[model samples]
Structures are given as C-alpha cells and as structure tokens.
Target chain A: MIDVRKALFGYSEWRWIFFFNKESWLSRKSKNGWVHKKRHSGKSGMALLLGPLFRSQNAPDPPPPPPTPPPELVWEDEV
Target chain B: MNRQLNEINLLRAIACIAVVVTHSITNYAKTYEPALFDQDKFITYFRFALLWATPVFVMISEVLISKNYPNGVRKGFLLKRVKYILVPYILIGLLKSYMHSEGQWSVFFQRSWEIVVLGHWHGFFVLVIFQFYILHILLGRFLQKSHPLPPILISFVLSFTYLYIHAGNKEYRVFIEQVYPFWDRTIFIGWLFYFVVAFYIGQNYERVLIFFTKHFYIPLITAVVSYVMMMNRVMDRVFVSVKSDRYDMLIFALSVFILALVLLRMIKKPNHTLIKLSHFSFFIYLTHQLTLPYLSNLTQTVANTFWSHVVILTFLGLATSIGWAMLFYESRLTKLFTGRIKALDQLAR
Candidate 1:
C-alpha cells in the first residue's frame, strides 16, 4: 500500500524546507543550497503540487484537502 | 494580545461554539431538527453558517499562532508542538476507545490507529492543528514578515484550482460537498489564504481591528441580508448549492468579521466567565457532538409539533454541549487523561 516515491523538489521532505532565522539563512543549507521551485508548465507554482500525504501509499491516509474556497472579488466585469 | 485584541479570544470561543452546533445539527447519521416549518430548509441556512466556523477557527489560529513563531528553530518548536498535540491525541483517543468500546477490544485497538491517522475529526481537531503547526513553521519562513500579497494570491489560485477540479470529477465534487466532512479536508491549499490573512492581521493587529471597526456595519448588514434571504428561500431558490462550500467561506468570513466587531464594541470588560469560556474552546469542540444521539432521537419523537421541537432541540443541544464541555474540563480525572490538565489548570487559574 505504500509508494516510496517522492516528487522532485517541493514534495521531497528535505527540499524547499526553510529555516528562516538569519543565522540559519546564512548557514550552508539555506544560504548556499536553496533554490525556489519554478513552473515550466502553465500550471500554478510548485507548492500546490507538493503534498506528500497525497503521495504516500502506506503512510496514514489523510483525507484530501478541502476544495478551495472561491473568490469574493466582485469584479466590475463579471456579472 | 494588545488591549483591542483581547476580545478576539472571545471570537475564537464564538467560532468554536458555531462549530459545535454545526457538527451537532448536521450529522447525516443523525437529524436533530424538527420537521414542520421546513427543517431541511433551516439546515440549509445553517449549512451555510457552519461552513465558516472551522475555517474561521483556523484563520483565527493563524492569526494568533502562525506568525508569532520564529522560523529558524526547528526540532525544538516541532517537539514542543508534539507535546501538546500527541499527548492529547493519544490520551483522548484512548479515552474515546474506552468509552465507545464496551467489549470490543479490537475496535478499541483500532481507535488508537485512527487517532494517529486522524479517523474522526468530529472527535478531535488535533489533526488540523497538527497540519497548521507544520504550515505555520514552513510558510511562515517564506512570508516576509510584512506583505499581505502572498496569502491574497494563494487564496485566489487555490480557489480556481478547486473549481477546475470540480468541473472534471464527480469524485472530487463529492469529497468537498459538506463544510466539515472528515473525508474532505482541503486545508493544504485552501487554508494558505486564511493563514496569510491571519498572519497579516496578527502582524497588523491594530490596522485590521480598526478597519473592521469602521466597516463593521457594512458586512454586518450584508451577512444579515444574505442569511435572511437564505432562510426565506429568496436566494438560491432556483439552484440549491449544497456542495457549494466556497460561498460558505465567503459568508462565514463576513459573519465572523461582523460578529467580531460587534462583540468588540459592546463589551468593554468581558465577563470573567466569558474569558473562562475561551480556555475550554478545544474541549468544547471535541464534545459538541456528544449530545447528537439524544437530540436526534428527541427530534424524531417530537416530529409532530415540528417548530416547537426545533426550538427545544436547539436550546437543549446548545446547553448539553456547553454542559458536557464544562464537565469534561472540570473533571479531576481529565488531568490524568489529557496529560496537560496540570499545565492547563495552571494556565486557567
């Protein structure tokens, strides 16, 4: 029931992990090794793609996240 | 919390109360409202209101806790979090198992796993709390301690993504159908916006409070209007969007905001009892549904005079919920079970 596969960057437990303290930021991991995951496809940023729970097979199965709430932007354009 | 921000805890308690009722009234497993005068219709309006409670709680959580943490620390913070989360997680889980499992040793054993894996959200919100702790630590790092744009963007993008997914798949559609369905948690992407909003307000506590202060009447009027229309069957009469959780978020945010402002303005010094209410918010959340079977049975029994039953059921459910919460919290033995009763007792005093 478990797939041990981890996605390329954001989904990796280690990748994109941040230590925000200035000290940690200046450390070898944060200062030298950090790179923002970018989109080559037209899809949204990498954060949306990085759910490790969704990926895990043997891991405790979490219910899929709630459907996103819609916009309240009452644009002058959209009737 | 600053002087103005103190009452926000009251908002948290209020949100928790709304959630208590939300779960109480809407268990498809149990229907506790009376039938006449359209009980189903009343629940629809309630469905809309309940949609916002947990999210509002999450949003408030983000406000109070997310940005407050310093990013650079790792193991220490996570460990501290585990102490709060896991102790209760393990304890109440065992407690639920013991209470629910008379002789079903196998079932009792199964609940331990559920607690770890988050089987019943009705019984515990610790799962969501765990998710938020991780998000707060991780995203809190990327958030430049001041900008509001990130959450703004996160909110819109995730909303569109869900809509797109909603278009293609019925399975996805069914998952997010209800506001707080245990099977349909959308926290990962959906709550980012809320977290950001919470963080922004937490940071600019005064600005948001002031802005909310000035515009209080506007949202208040609109929410009342929407709620009245919802109850009157004026809006959405043509197409009832039971699964339309998005609007629930929109309206709930509005309601919570307006409610927050109104409560803030009215209470110069909140009753000490009200302050006491905030401490049991989590416990109250855990037990709101405990009275469901009693209320639901009572509802079905009084189905003849539906409106009167509705009134009685509402009052009884509310009282039973608060009473159960107080009893659980005040129990001397609860300290031994939750492990933090000692700690919480110290804080409460």
Candidate 2:
C-alpha cells in the first residue's frame, strides 16, 4: 500500500489534484474513484418529485442536453 | 430483542423501496411508451405501493404529535408548524422548482403554488401528514378507544367507494389520473381509510411487533403478485374501471407486514453505519432529488454510453444519499435545524 500518510509530502500535480480540484477528480477521474466515490450522489427531489411515474432506464444518459421546453405562447390565448 | 422492532417503521422503508420502483417505472413510461408495467398498474396496485410510503409518514406524524403535545392540538402556532413540516415542505419545493426551472422565472413562480401545495401531486403525502396532525388528538383517541374493527371496516368501505366513483366518473383531471387510476389516499379520494388504518395499526404496539416478526413471506408474495396483477390491469373491470382498488389493502398489509418483519430482524445487529443510514433515510428522500440534476450535469461530460451513465448515476445516487445521511447524523446541522426538541427527534433506525 502506498503509505498515504507519507505520500502527503508529494509535490506538483499530486498537490494540485489533492487539494484544489479534489472531489470531482477523485470521484470522476482517479482510478480509486470507485473506492472513494461521493457518499451523497446523483439523487434529487425532482427525481422523486416527478417520480414513480416516468420510469427512465436505470440511469439514463445525461438527457440529451435537456432540450428546452417549447416556449408557451401565453398571449395567443387572448387573441 | 426480536420483538421490539417498529413494524410500521419497517414498512416505511418498504414504502421507500416502492417509491424507488414507482419512480423507476414512471420514468420508463414517460420516455418510452410501453413500460415494464402498464400505466394503469401504478394506480390500481402500484399506487398502493405509495399508500404505505407516505401514510407511514402519517403514523410518524401522529406519533410525534401525540408525543410532543399530548394535551390538545396546538391552535395555530405558525412558527411551530413551520419549524418541522412547513419549512421542510416549502424549502424542498423551492429547491425542486429552482432545480427543475423548466421555463422562465415567471412560469416557475406561477406554478410554485402547484409545487408547494401539490408537490407533483405527490404533495398529497404532506397534506395527508397535515391531515393526520389535525386529526391526531381525535384520531389518537379513536384508535385508543374504539376496537380496530370499526376503523378497519370504515377505511375499507371508504376505499371501495372511492374506487367505484373514480371508475364511474369518466372525466379526467390529468393531474389526478395516474397512468392507471384508482381510489388512492395519496390523491385523497379515500384517504380517510388509509389515515385511519395507519392510526389503528400504529396503536397496537404488540400486534405491530408480532405482525412484523411472524409472516415475512406473505407480504413478499403479496407485493410481487400485486405488482403483477396491477401491472397487467387484470382486475380493472372487477375492481375499478381504469384501475382497481381491488386488493390494495391486502397489498399494503403484506408490504407493511413484510417490512416490519424485515426491519425487526435486520435491526437486531444494526451497527453505526446502518443506524446512520436509517437515520438519513428521510433526508435521502427529501434531498436526493436536489442532488441528482447537479450530478447529471457533471457526469454528462464524462460518462460515455447509456449503460455507463446509469451505472454512474446509480452509484452516485447511493453514495450521495449515504454521504448526506452521514453528514446530517454527524454534523451540528441536525441539532441546529431541529432546535431544542430532543425526545421526538427522528431516530436513525
């Protein structure tokens, strides 16, 4: 095992990745990502909010950049 | 140790699982036409899945209310109401609206009432909790005083009545109609039944404990069968028109029984981690939706295939949920937010 207590002295990229951009890199980038994955993850109220109704694939792709909902023509009703 | 388990609490967790399935199935239906289960199944059978999910919440409310103010219902303490129920409800709704800001600021605000009051129509869960609070003292007295049969029979009749009406009434509200329709307490057609059921079931401490410990598989089988029957709309004509209230209580009974059993058994050796996880279950439900969109945005860049995306999302979902639970359990935030009320504080279990 790379004695992490000793590895703390490492410099440059190690320090940068270690300190600055930590969680995203570690969770998404570094190989140990899976082991040290974020505990609170990709859940939200909207999922529950819109849930038990719209069943997506276990985890769907990032929803194709979320195509904007068509603009409602509120004024058209008055006409 | 075998007996002390809160079966109702266990069923609450079962409700959590059902919510997971319901959401999963709902997403599938919205995106793809044919779902794992038909739309109708959700109301008739699966909707019952939600029955326990939130009414267990009602029981929780009654228990908490009775514990806190045993005398009479507080007239209208805005601050008190806001502290627990209102604050969480509004804050969560606002967070949902902000995250899901589907349109312009005006549009979101226009619908904020919808979200705040209705919560994707699932808001009925909160309303039901409020209903329980309003009825707590009375309901508690009723449960204490009356034999279980009257409430049970009343709830049964009311549920059947709702099922009959919902079926006969052809007009669709879109909002009230789930893919499959039925008389559901969550949507409040026959909610009185479920509310009373929760109250009654909650009152019998020994029966609750025994029920959970005794017949575990019956519920498991019932849930599985209910899922199948409702998913297929097999009982529609006989039970309800669009969907059926056919065997909802049976399903709930099974779900609750099984859940109580599981919770009792599992809780025997609940370590710190499990306790912590259980502790955060509510927050998990409350906040998970907030976290998902952010993760979706972040991961869209890195994740390649649909499969990989889902894996990441699932992993992240579990991780973030646990993380949040851990944070709350370990942090000062729980205390800070909860205030000085200590005894009725939600247990990790």
Candidate 3:
C-alpha cells in the first residue's frame, strides 16, 4: 500500500527545501561580501550544509577588516 | 502615486462573480449524475467559458504588483502578503479541516497540514498567487526593462507546453506526481504567460488602454472564436477533463481579459456596487466554499429545475459571502482575513 501521508506532504516539503537551498546558495554566492567569504572559508562546509535549514539564525556575520589596512583607510572606516 | 483605476474594480467584480457562478455549477453538478440533467451540455459550455475567471484574477494581481513597484518592491512586500493573505489561508484551512474532521484529532491535524502545505482545497489559488509574488520579486525588474513581445511569446510557449505535457502525457504526469505531488495547479509554469503579459500591460497602462479601446472588436472576436474552439475541443473529448489549465484555454483567457478592459472603459460613472463586491472578493473567495454547501441545500428546497437551482445558488453564494465578509470587516481584529487592509487600500489609490 502507498504511504498516503508521505505522498501528500513529505514530497512537497522536500521539494521546497531543495528549491530554497538552491536559491539561497546562488544568491549568496553572487553577492560580494561575507556570504561569499563564508562560503570559501574553511568552516563553510557545515554552515553551507545547514544554511537552508536555519537560514535566519545561521546567516554569516560581516567579515572582519583586513589586518594590514592603511592607517588612513582604517581611520575613514572607523569614522 | 497611482491613480484610482475604476476599471480594475469592475473587472474584479466581474471575475469574482464568474468564479462564484462556476463553483455554484460545480456544486450542483456534483449532486447528480451528468446524464441525469438535460442541460448538462450547456452547463459544461458555461463553465468552460468562465475558465478565464481565475486566470484573470491572477493577472490582476500581477498587474497591480508590477504597476505599483516598477522599480521593484521593498523588503516588506512579502511580509505584508504573509499577514493579510497567508494568515487567512492557513486559518481557513484549519477551519475547513475542523469541519470535515468529525471530531478526530489525527484526521484534523493531518488534513490541516495537507491543506496548508499541499494546498488540497479550492483556495489553492492562494499558493499560486504566493508563487507569483516570489516571481515578481525575482524577475519583475528584468522583465520591466526588456522588450515585452519576446518574453510574452516565450512564456506562452512555456505555459502551453507544460499544460500539454501534464494533461496529455500520463507517464510524465505520474513521474511529476512522484516529485511534486498535488502541484498540477499550484505551480507557476502553467500560468506564466498571464503574469508576463499582465506585467507589461500594468507597466504600460495608458498605451494598452488606448490600443484596446481603438480595436475593441479584436479581443471580442478572438474571445468568441477561442471560446467556441474550447467548447469544440471539450465536446470532441480532446480535453479529457473540465479543468481551467487546459492548453487551449490560454488564448481564450487572454482574449477575455483584454475584452473585459475595453468594455469596462466604456462606462463613465464608477459603479459603487461592483466596487464593494470587489472589496469583498478576496474574503468571499476564502469563505464561499464553507457557505456554498449550506446555501445549496437551502436553494434546493425552492428550485426544482436545474438552472433555477444553479442561478439561485450563485446569487446566494455571492450575497452571503459578501455579507459575512462585511461582518468580519467591521472589527479591527477580524479584518485581517477580509483582505481589506488599510495599507492595501491606500496603495490602491
């Protein structure tokens, strides 16, 4: 016998998860900041894997400033 | 700021009435065998002619969205829809599940979840509309900047091809079912052409109005001819079902949409009654199914003939739906489900 519950609800949820994951991944990859940096950083694997499931909470924070920045640039950025 | 489009209000009234009529016929038809009624063929023709109803509703939504947000929507767009539209959708789904649950908790929860997620109900149009909302956010700007003709043609082909494959090919249909069950109607591919076409029309409202006004006969003629062809296909069993998503209906629906705009333009004075009906349309759409069965039972007592039953049911459905919606609209707390949000009203003007 067919599992009616899975046929009705499970299939659509799985498709939705797949769609959102693809969309968020592509969008994040195309953007130019922490999202891109986070994807390339060594800790990105688990974050990428769990991104779709906990998109809001697991959103990558802003990347820190480069340590070797010029003093003027650092002052302007601080200002 | 957008000017008040009185024509959109009238069009909303017309589409809302057509939807109620179509559902009324469906309910009455379900009560008896098709062969039992002598007017079954005519009823079929009428129902098929009104296939434009739901598609027009979808087009109206895209038109407003594209026109209102030509530069693209801000961040709060989807959030507003979730509050006004999705909340009511889920509330109604739970209400429906409760009605049919027969006091069983498991059945209630399961059915409620199915209705919420799978859209296994008459109000599945909400899910389809939600898809268009996301589509607008994603593609509306690109579509606005590009030439309309190419995208229109491409979307038409995509819509027609998808419908043909889903309806004509059983093997693919079954395969699709495995991957995305209960998505034959809720998916965007079957209705993409309407969105693309309506997006352009909404962006170029004045030019489109002038063109349609100058050549009113064009859509009128095409609407009649395509409708007749649709009826012929149905009679010949070329369409195995009486669904609105048939490939043949794409042309018919588009023509009726243009024709409606032309006809509504001829009137000078604003129709207050139609405007009110338009205001209550979304709420009516949500709650009409709940009231229709009870109204059908009441109408059956007085009307012996099939046509009389259907006509009476249609009127009662519209009236009671509007009446109940008005009662709900009177309160601040209950107004969320009525689709008459103050923000939306302000935006409309």
Which candidate number has the best TM-score? 3
lDDT (Cα, tens digit) per residue for candidate 2, span B256-305? 54465455556545344433334445555555555655666565676754
Runs in model 1 lying further than 4 Å from the true structure: A1-79, B27-40, B70-76, B97-102, B111-116, B163-168, B171-182, B221-251, B262-266, B295-333, B336-349
Residues A5-72 of candidate 3 have per-residue lDDT tens digits of 44543334343334344345534443643222222333233335675554544457657878972211
Best candidate according to lDDT: 3
Where is model 2 more than 4 Å wrong at Cα?
A1-79, B1-14, B28-81, B100-105, B121-123, B172-189, B211-228, B234-250, B257-259, B291-312, B321-349
* Model 3 ranges off by over 4 Å: A1-79, B1-4, B34-39, B341-349
**lDDT of predicted model 3:** 0.76
Show the colliding residue pairs in model 1: A2-A58, A65-B185, A65-B186, A66-B185, A66-B186
The alpha-carbon lDDT assigned to residue A24 of candidate 3 equals 52
**Candidate 3 colliding pairs:** none
- Candidate 3 per-residue C-alpha lDDT over B1-349 given as tens digits, one digit per residue, 9 for 90 to 100: 1234788888988898888887787777766546422446777777777878888998998888887788888889999899889988988778888998899999999888777778878788888889899988889879977999999999999999999898779998888778887656777899999889998998997789899899888888988999888777666656646666678889899899988887887788888778767877787778888888888889878888778988899899998977776677667777766765442354447
Interface DockQ per candidate: 0.01, 0.01, 0.01
The DockQ-based CAPRI class assigned to model 3 is incorrect
* DockQ of model 1 vs. true complex: 0.01
The better candidate by TM-score, 1 or 3, is 3
Q: Give model 1's docking category.
A: incorrect
Q: Of 1 and 2, which scores higher on lDDT?
A: 1
